[model samples]
Target: MNYDECHTVKTICGPHASCHNTAGGFFCLCHTGFAQLSGKTNFTGYGAGCQDVDECLQQPCGPHGVCINAEGTFLCSHMTPPMTSHLQTTLSPFVHCLSNLLKDQSIIDNCFTKRLQQPPADQFCSLINSTLAFARRMCEQKGEYRQKSASVTLKDVTSFGNKFVADGSGVESATVFLGAMENFATLAALASPTQELKAISSAHLDLDVRVIDVTNRRFLAHERLTLRAKNDTLDIYMKTVTEEQQTGASVVVFLSYTDLRSLQRGEFVTEGQPQSHLLTSSVVSVVIGNRRHRQLRDGVNITLSHTSQTQGSLSDWRIFCVYWNHSPSSSHWSPEGCEVIQSNGTHTTCGCQHLSSFALLIATSKVTPPANRLQHHGILPNPAPIQNVLQLRYRMV
Candidate 1:
């Protein structure tokens, strides 16, 4: 058939298409990069209805890739590296360290194996690994593993020389310092008698901890920490401790111990001297003998009371308290209003007059000069006592 004759015959096709005469009739063809909207590629209709093909809908790109649709074709390109999300930035440093460590197969296997010994192995392993990683990071960050470099300058030597009237004055000062250290060491050795008593006592103790925002004078969080004299090591369960109220606030923690008598020998609380540290920009941990203090923000106090069930009796327990402030200029610890309120062989109650970061030290007998006394007797007190109408008493259950 001639083209004109085929055209005269009412050939059917859709828009955006062309009609061409074939042997007997005409057929419709769509434009490039497009398809027949009605699902017909070649048609004997007057017009061939065509639409753009959505190549992106077919997902022609690989993982981490993007597809760009154009005319009748699509282009696939790799996506750019993803920006660090807020969640990643907010993740604790310990989590990052543990994630890196757990990537090792041997560590994972050994950890999992150890965890299997305890029921709920997976959960315990996770907690243990995370805590270890956090502690590791803290130690490294605090330079515990790094030797500090002391840079002595000529100016320092000159200053030292000028501070003294005679050439032997510097030597004299060094001698005095060494003598004072020896005296302190002797005092500490004399105080070692408590260890003998602690060795005799087999009491288990429970710590009731409360965090208070001293600036605002409000309670933030309360938690119970349990310790057994036999374990030698204790786990501080702090997963539920919330930190909602800790932003830019001075915090104080109160640790109340059950069976103060068993602890009186200073077995559980004598690991280190009172020290304060800023764990992070928003978190702080303070160690005072047997008690630990941390800052949290949420305003919820969880009070736990329980009686001692250990074999040993608490007849000889005495309470000793000390505290530290994080102020750079003055962080030394001193005793506050801790005094014996009531006492029995099984239990003892103590009262504190003020709120600061304090720990409860258990000893068999009271030590002279008080636990708050500085190594050097000349150091002045940093915290003054705060008076309150309400008396706070820590009763051992």
Candidate 2:
């Protein structure tokens, strides 16, 4: 009988396919965003099922955004539509902290700002800690803001770090510096090309940005990011690795700090060595996405160069790769997750399981020696004299 085959047999079509009644017959049509495996437009038999069509291959997202394929759809992170609207009152704290850091100023400007309205010495930490607090908040907010860079020089950066360390503000410049790197990282990563190398440079700091395509490890030349300052260099390797469950565009940023020597004086990180000293005055900060607060299964390797200096004597110093750690009571450097891979008089290389601001420290047991016993007793030697030959790697957690 010429009965409606499409309506009589409710299960006429396979999943994701619809049965269309025709002249005394019925045809199967794949649903939107799906295609029949056989590539036939119309069919009556269930020989094939509908398959998800990868719209991303067609670049449906746009010109500026990267398309991410899904089971039946796709997504795009467009660089347009300024994320400023998404920011709320809660972001005020970050705005305040970051605005203070982005000011372009020379050492003289910082020193003579308002002779009658001088800021507290601890303003360095106060500003830095606030920015870091915002970074911690970003893990939850994932919000993006305006693009900004600090205009201070390496000399001024050194001066601020020293000022904070001297003020005993209970926060390390490493922590502050780390916060600032991620702060800029968030800005750079939020709206970036999926597979392109981007370099932003100014007098104060330089940044490298790369967005990873998870589907392709060799997506572009961005798998490694390197930043070079006047006399220092930072290399961030394996920027593509991320947690297995983590499924977002991985962005890597490598930053050079102004100066870390000031913060090193009081924030020694060696265990049981209260008098430990940082060998090189150089310190650097980096972040891959927002994973700085946790450890990565496949850790990232970083290489850093040390300052050049000639010393008359050397001591039995141990090299350590450390990151800044903060607590309610105090802030210090910690080498818990890092190990020295290689080191020389001028550089050190370290491998760390976490992602954070990294630096190198050389520790030697400090002790008082009487002049009478200088030649007789087993007295401790001088603190390790590390010349500019230094390269380092360190992570978070």
Q: Number of the top candidate by TM-score? A: 2
**Compared with the true structure, what per-residue lDDT tens digits does model 2 show for residues 1-397?**
6778778877787765678787878788775556877788777885355766666568765564434333333333433221232342544333333333332122112322222145537455454543344333322233422222112222233333334434443244445455554544544343332223323234334443444544334333334444344334444444334434133345555655544444555577556455556556356666655342456654555555555551212224566678776654776778877766555555555666776667776666544321221111111112122233222221111
Off by over 4 Å in 1: 1-130, 133-319, 322-334, 353-397
Best by lDDT: 2
Q: lDDT tens string, model 1, 78-144?
A: 4233224343343322222222222222332335333434444454344344333332332243342
TM-scores of all predicted structures: 0.20, 0.48
Model 2 off-target regions past 4 Å?
1-174, 194-204, 215-240, 245-248, 310-316, 364-397
Error of 1 at 144 (Å): 29
